[model samples]
Target: MVRIDLKEKEAGTGTDLDSVLAKQRAAFNAHTNPPWSERKANLQKLGKAIEEHAEEFQKAISEDFGNRAYEETTIAELLVIKGGISHALKHTKHWMRARRAPTALQYKPASNRIIPQPLGVIGIISPWNYPLQLAVMPLIGALGAGNRAMIKPSEYTPRLSDLLKRVLGTIFTEDEVYVATGGVKVASAFSALPFDHMIFTGSTSVGKIVAAAAAKNLVPCTLELGGKSPTIIDESANMDTAVARIANGKLLNAGQTCVAPDYVLMPAEKINSFSDAIIEKAESFYPTFAGNKDYTSIIADSHYARLQDLLEDAENKGARIRVAGDDDKQQLAKERRVPLTVVTETTPDMKIMQEEIFGPLLPVVASETLEDSMQYVQSHERPLALYWFGEDKSKREKVLTETISGGVSINETAWHVVQEDIPFGGVGPSGMGAYHGEHGFETFSHMKGVFTQSRFSQGKNLFPPYTDKTRKMLGLMKKIL
Candidate 1:
């Protein structure tokens, strides 16, 4: 029988993780391995709660973002979460089932199997980009795997964070699930907690801090950090389709998405044409920038200023900028709704080129050949996602095999993340580990291998002191006699 092994609890910072975990562990002791039916019911209830309060969540997220697009929230956050829960509920039984394992020929009298067990308690630290989904999606996996959980949502989205506290409180008891909301100190304490497993989604720099804290407790973690993901337009690519898709991915969530295309690598000969096509696509996507309810604003003034600083740094360092439409730059700044601005002739010294560019700014670089482009990608920190826009199978295969990222989108952008079946995460500097679908269930679980020996087996043949008869038998076995 599974039980909470909480021998001692560590002192934490400003957050109440210690107290909350104590309760959760105590509750887990009573209901260690929740039956499949119970787990499924939890997921279904969570899904139902989300649907029931969809309008409230939609309004809260919109207010948090200043003016988030309702449709974007529906498609990106709510619908995606519902789909994830459905997928988890559908295959959780298979994920939890004990599977037969192969035994060696010498162990003919023994049988082997592997069983997946919950890891007690898990902690999830979600970022502000997609606040609700990032926080709850990991919970879906943890609950499905029969593990209790605690969540810490980003403090930047106060409305959403507060709403989640209330809604989650109604759906789940404090022992079953806990949602903590606070600033950096609380995050520090949350990260330092002795969780069975922790998953953090945020910037690479912050992920490093979280990793250090988790290491103190020897806590295994999944870091879904962000880096400057790239989208490459091949020489043989369809410029119209490529530009359209890349713009959609970049502009979504106002380019706050971790998997959004940070920059574009297009042929030097077609940089002008590609930039123009992208400008046209951006205008079509957000026809009215200032008052358009469809376009999302930057999360806060500080982020808005950061984007401005990036633009100034790029422009001062001799990068060319193209406005998507006839929008007033000053007014856009005041309103926190920066339109899709494409930068060309970008150099490494520019801030946009140096950073993740988590805004609606696209840096289009000139690459002479695909090999050169791949080389440039390799030289930097590995990114969370890479988008290659081309129809050539050979070229695509070369890029796929030659380079590595957490995930990739062939001839498209940003769609690989919501697929549910594949593991989504990062590599090297971008981040570590993956989650989603069955991979997610396993991430929060431990696969214990079991071996059973037959009672009437010939096990005594090899258990005694070394003798002439045993030596002879060993020799005969070695020679296959």
Candidate 2:
């Protein structure tokens, strides 16, 4: 009974989501959910399909976002997909095995175990920043946990979503996995659906709305939202390594990544050296970013406008702007690309310092003491990720223990997400719930407890009416048990 809903082609053609949900529910009710072995096989099949269509996926991503680098896309998006599949295949058997539990003495001759069961149909809403990886990663977990899934990719990256649908449709039946494509209306309707579980990856604001919608049906959610993630550089830190790593993380995808170093904290004396090194690194990497075809890209006009607004506001507030390449605003604006600009003498009141600047602008905040820097970060919203660039173990440990974030890295940036064995998620305003490896598989599953008892009877004396002896015996049994 499921059909494609193509009404109003201009609005973006979305599948009949109601029918899709109905079909999934029917499948769930009929106990047709894929077994653990079948789930593993399907995941491996999907991973193989991604590998076969790697070129097409890369091309679609580049076309959608203007200049996504092939190698970067492969490492960030495709490799993560492959890693998820590999992790699932390796751990599916173990994950599906029933876990035994200790039984109390009172329950003699009885055994107990916890069983991991599927949570029926799961809905995944992905963002455009890292569309392919974010969309497929959650699906891998749901599949590994033996659940059907429906994915709704961001409308901003329409071509990539279409390409994903075409590629995935070949490997998976609609009843097993479905990809729904459309604009905001479709996204809203999709969110409102009564899924057993949902995972949404996007801005914190939109994540709130998604959570609200999911709340209506009491659907548990895993929200991957963004916040102003910070990178702390102490005086004892390696200046060269810190600058290089920060520059690389910030400039990737033109600073579109959620975990990209939003700003840096450094001692007053080290500010000049750090800023100089950052500029040098930027030139070596981009050379001529405004005209360079090798460098990646910005999302679109509106995003560029927003970044520009942040820069203009910062500039007007007496902050010195240092451009890595050209300072010609008109030329940069015309190309819809802005050079990596570092803002110094920034205050907490500025818009750039207040909001999560999802762009190429990097603000360098100077701290007189390490305590001041830690306190500064503590005052702000807990970030999705935190990076520390110091060789001193004590200093690093202090920051790690005192400050709170979704995840943290020492001496590097943004590499923690690739580890399939570790959990990746956020806290507070950043997000809620963890997903990536086995943690992701567990998120989409309901752990049910099972117990079996022997037929032997040991309580025949309890059938007698209340008496002095019986009461004393019952009291003694209760105490011993």
Candidate 3:
């Protein structure tokens, strides 16, 4: 067995990324296939650590976000991760077990089975939006697959990143599960490592960079990239219910969610009513922007400024800006908060229409018909999540079959990601692969198919030089297969 003292890894500098990856690779090679008992224990320890430091994590994340609500942190980050851990612990045994597979009639007495084995060291690059969940959710999948992991969290959330490095180090050694902390340089260095598999959760632009970096090493990647997720309001939908649900999903984390509805496409006639209801719903959810604990602040000043720029460009392009919640100018500036602002009368030429609005800015686009809305969605890049609100079964099916996205939440928003049974990921430009629950286990594992042959097997008949007997066998195979 090979080993390296990781005491000097406390700094997690960009310069040491290669050495750290080497150390983790050595540890993973030593235990290529850990038993279910050991994997379960690691998961348990991680869950315990999370539970023990839940409060600290909440506080640290809030400090990073300049006032991320306590409940928001608990619901979106802590609880989601804990739920994933519990789900993984419950199902990992079955996921790890080798399952019997059927053999062909010509190969009777021979049997087949698939053995799921852990990949070597996994590299995880998590985003700043939901720091703890993005970082630990993939970690759960890696550990469950019996793979060692190295995480590089976003630098935007320094407090959470430092806390993650410190807290995770307490339960696992650096070689077992290391946390590399730094800015873009360290992140770039981390992505360039030759790991068995890499998982990155961030924007499409950055995901492209990470994918390119991993491609240089020929490392497979599971990118959870973000795009402009769209929401469709059907003609038959209840305006109140649709608006309320969209509002909740959009305003959560102050609309920093990757799957948040970037824009809404509804019937042209109903746009006014829908916009009114959404504004009212936003106000009801967050009566005031400042001093509102429920309303999460933008993660950083730069992001806040970018959101303002998006709104400004839209307004300059003849879009109407509706401030939903009461604006507290002093508090907004002090805490870097952007109120729930809705942009209507938007055109494709607007900057807000082009980029992923990872903020509290929602653009409501008007569509003449359901077909028109679907056409609009199809014309653009596929999004991470597509939402449709309606009771019409046919229309819902049309949207489902016609549109392609990472996931779909009918009559709802952002709920598809929390279901552990479903594989959560993006499609095309949005993302490439998926991970969650068993899907995650499969992603981190190499499913090796093993075939056992018996002495009486007939497969040997087809492996010889051309002969009358071989021709007869070939004729039989053609008939059966």
lDDT leader: 3
Model 1 lDDT-worst window of ten:
1-10
Error of 2 at 122 (Å): 0.7
Alpha-carbon runs more than 4 Å astray in model 2: 1-15, 104-109, 453-481
* For every candidate, C-alpha RMSD to the true structure in Å: 5.4, 3.9, 4.2
lDDT (tens digit, per residue) of candidate 2 on 115-183:
898899999999999999999999999999988899999877877888898998899888778888877
Error at 351, model 1, angstroms: 2.2
TM-score of each: 0.94, 0.92, 0.96
Q: lDDT of each structure?
A: 0.89, 0.86, 0.89
| Model 2 collision count | 0
Those runs of model 1 whose alpha carbons end farther than 4 Å from true positions after fitting are: 1-15, 456-459, 468-481
Q: What digit string (tens of lDDT, one per residue) describes model 1 on residues 1-481?
A: 1121221122234445898998998888888888899999999999999999999999999988888988899999999999999999889988989999997656667899999999999999999999999998999999999999999888788788878988999989999988887777778889999999999999999999999999999999999998999888888788788988999998999898999999999778899988898888899988879878999999888889898899999999999999787877677877799889999999998989989989899999999899989999999889999999989999999999998899999988999999999999999888899999999999999999999997865556777896777787677567753
Query: Model 1 — TM-score against the truth?
Result: 0.94
Query: Higher-lDDT candidate among 2 and 3?
Result: 3
* Highest TM-score against the true fold, candidate: 3
For candidate 1, the lDDT comes to 0.89
Q: What is the TM-score ranking, best to worst? A: 3, 1, 2
